[model samples]
Target: MTFVPSPSPPAVRQPGATALFCLPGAGASAGLFAGWDEDLPATIEAFALEPAGHGLRTDEEPHTDLDTLLADLMDAVRPYAGRPLALLGHSFGAVLAFELALRLEREGTPVRHVFPVAARAAAVRTGSPPGREPTDEELKARLRALGGTPAPVLDDEEMFALLLPALRADFELTDAYRYRAGDLLDCPVTAFAGADDTVVPWASVKAWGACTRGRFTVHRVPGGHFFPFAHRSARADLLRTLAQELDRRPGTAPRRPDTPEHG
Candidate 1:
C-alpha cells in the first residue's frame, strides 16, 4: 500500500521535545485527534497515524493482518526518529501502539512511554469468538452501543457503506491477534480506562502493567468507551496528566539554545 510522504520536521525543536504519535480505534480515522495539538503541551508534538482505507487513504484497502499494518506504520513513523517518541492509542489503536512499541524497542529505539486508552491488555483475547464474523448489522449495533459514531452517519446509507469496509477489516485484525510472550517493554506504560465502560472491564485494563518493566499506572477517567473524545473535561484532564508525566521524565524538558537550529 502507498503512503503519503512524511511531512518535514521543524528545523528547530525545543530541546528534548517529544514526538507523540497517536492512533485511533476501529472505524475511526486520524481525524479523531484533529485538534489535539492545541490541547497538548508545546514540548510534545502530536502526529495522528491512520491505517489504510481511513481518513485521507479512504480509497485504499485496509489490512486484515497485524504484520502488514505494522510494517506500513513503522515506515510512516521512522522519519521522526530524531526525537524522543511516545505513543498513545485508543481501543484498536491501543493494541497497535503496543505492538509498535515492541518493534521500535527491538530495533534499538527506546520508547519514552506508551498510553493505551480504553483497551484491554495485549495478552487478553478480544473481538469476536472463533469462526464468527460479525455481520454489517451487528457492526452497526456495536457502533451504536459505543456511541462514538453519530446517529446521522449510521442512518446515512452512503456514508455507512463507505465506513463498513475499514470497520470489518479492523475487527478481523483484532480477532486474529494472538499475543506471543517476549521481553517486557522498558518504558513506562499508562493505561486509561473509562470508569463506566462496560465493553472492557477494569481488571483487563489493569493487566497492562505486566507489559512493562518500567513504571505502570492506570487512570480511571469518566465516561464510556469513547471518553477521550466524548467528554471534554475528561479529555483535558487526560492531556494534562500526559504532559505532567512527560515533564517528570529527565531530559524531556524544553531547553533554549543560543545556536540557530537546523534539522
Candidate 2:
C-alpha cells in the first residue's frame, strides 16, 4: 500500500507569557485545536503536537507502543520544554502527555502542570490486553463510537482506507502497551473527564491521584469521549483560568525541579 502521511498543520501561533502544548485525541490531527489560540488568554501561547507517525513525520512508520512514540515526541518537544511549560492532551493524547511529564521529570526537565482530557489517570491499573491489532471492522466501530472522526472520513471507502492504518496503529499503542508504575512528578496534575465517557470512567480517572502525591484535581466536564472538541470554549477557558491562577500565585513553590507538593 502506498504511504499517504498525515496532514501538516500551519505555523499558526499566538504571543503569550506562557506556552501551552495541546495534544489531540485518537485518530485526530492537530486541526482540532486550530482556533484555541485566539480563544485562550494571551498570558498563554498555544501550539499543537502532531505525533511522529502522522503529520510532518508521516514518512515514518507508526510505533506499536506509546513509549516508542514518546521517544520521538521527547526529541521533537524537548527544545520547547522549558520551565513553566504546561501540557494538555485529550483521550489517548492525555495518557501520553501525563506519562511524558513523568519521564521528563526523570530526565530532570521540570513540568509546570499537566491537563488531560477524556483519559484515565496514570496510576489507574489497566488489565493486560488480549490482542494488539483490531479487525478493520472493529477499528471503524470504535472510531464511530468515540465521535472524534468525521462521518465522511469514516464512511467513504477511499478516506476510510486512507485513515485506517493510522487509526489502528493508535489503537494498538493504547491496547498493547501496559501502564507500569513510575516516579511521581513534582508538578501538579489536572484531569478533565467527560461525564459520560464510557471507555475511561470517572472512577478510573480519579485514580490519577496515585501518580501524584496530593497535587491533583479532577474536573468533570459535560460530554462524552471528545469533550474538549465538543465544548471547545468552555474547556479552553477552564484551562486558561487555571493556568492563570497558577501564574498569579507568587512563590507558589519553585517553578523548577519538580517543586515538592504538600499533603
Candidate 3:
C-alpha cells in the first residue's frame, strides 16, 4: 500500500531551530502528540510525523514492508531536515526512529539526538516469537494489557474495525524486523521506558547504548507501557528538560559521518 503524509501546518521557523519529529505507536495517528510542543522552547519545533492509514491520511492504505515505510518516512521528513533535527518515537514508532536514524547517518544527515520512548533496543535479544496479525481476543488482551485503548473505543465494534488493519500491519512490521549488525551512530541516544514496563525491560532499553558511539542515557517514568499518555504532568516535565538539553548544544547541523571532524 502507498503512503501519504499529512500536510504540515504553516509556521514561522526560527533560525537555527531544531525540528523534533515525534512518531506515534501502532494504530495511532500524529494527533497522539497534539499540544506536545506547547511546553518546549521556541528553538525546538515539534512536529508529528503521521503515517498512512491513520489520522488525516486514514483513507490511505497502511504499509506492511519496512523498506517501503522507511522510504515514505524519509521522503516526508527530508524537507524539514534543512535545519538541525531530533527524533522521538514511542513504542512501534521508536523502531521506525531507530532505523530512520541509521538511514540518516548513512545519508550524511544524522540528527542531533534520538529519543526512543517505550521501545526496546535493536540489539536486545528476546525469547518472544515473530509478530503476526492477532486474533480479536489476542488484540483485545494486548490493548487491555497496555491500558491505552479507551473502554468506549474497545466496546465499539465499528471503531475497532476501523482501527484493526493498520494496527495489524504495524504488528506484522515489528514482528518481521530483524536486527542487522551496523555501524554505531555518532549522535547520542536517549531511551525512555516505563519503570514497570513488562513489554520492554531495563536490559532491552539499556541495549540501546550498543547502537551508538556517542552518549546514551535511559530515563524511567513511573507507570506502565503507555505512561506518557497516562501521566501528562511527568511527561511535560521530561519534555522541558529535553528542551533545555537541546538548547545547550551548539547551533549546527546534525553531525555526519563524512564530515571532517567526525572522520
Among all candidates shown, the one with the greatest lDDT: 1
- Deviation in angstroms for 232 in model 1? 2.5
lDDT of candidate 3 at residue 83, scale 0 to 100 = 80
Winner of 1 and 2 under lDDT: 1
Supply every candidate's count of residue pairs whose N, Cα or C atoms clash at under 3 angstroms.
Answer: 0, 0, 0
Candidate 2 Cα errors over 4 Å, as ranges: 1-16, 130-132, 248-263
Candidate 3: deviation at residue 7, Å?
4.0
* Poorest lDDT segment (10 consecutive residues) of candidate 2: 1-10
lDDT of 3: 0.75
| TM-score for each candidate, following the candidate numbering | 0.88, 0.82, 0.87
lDDT against the true structure, each candidate: 0.81, 0.68, 0.75
| Candidate 1 per-residue lDDT over residues 32-64, each given as its tens digit | 887777778779878888788898888789988
Task: Give the C-alpha lDDT of model 2.
Answer: 0.68
**lDDT agreement of model 1 with the native:** 0.81
| Candidates 1 and 2, the one with greater TM-score | 1
lDDT for each residue of candidate 2 in 1-263, tens digit (9 for 90 to 100)? 00112134323244335556777767776667777766666677677777755655556677667767888667656665553577788877877887778788888887777877778665664645575456888889998988868898888988888777678788777665566776566777777767777778777777766666536667776667876667666656566656664575544543322212111
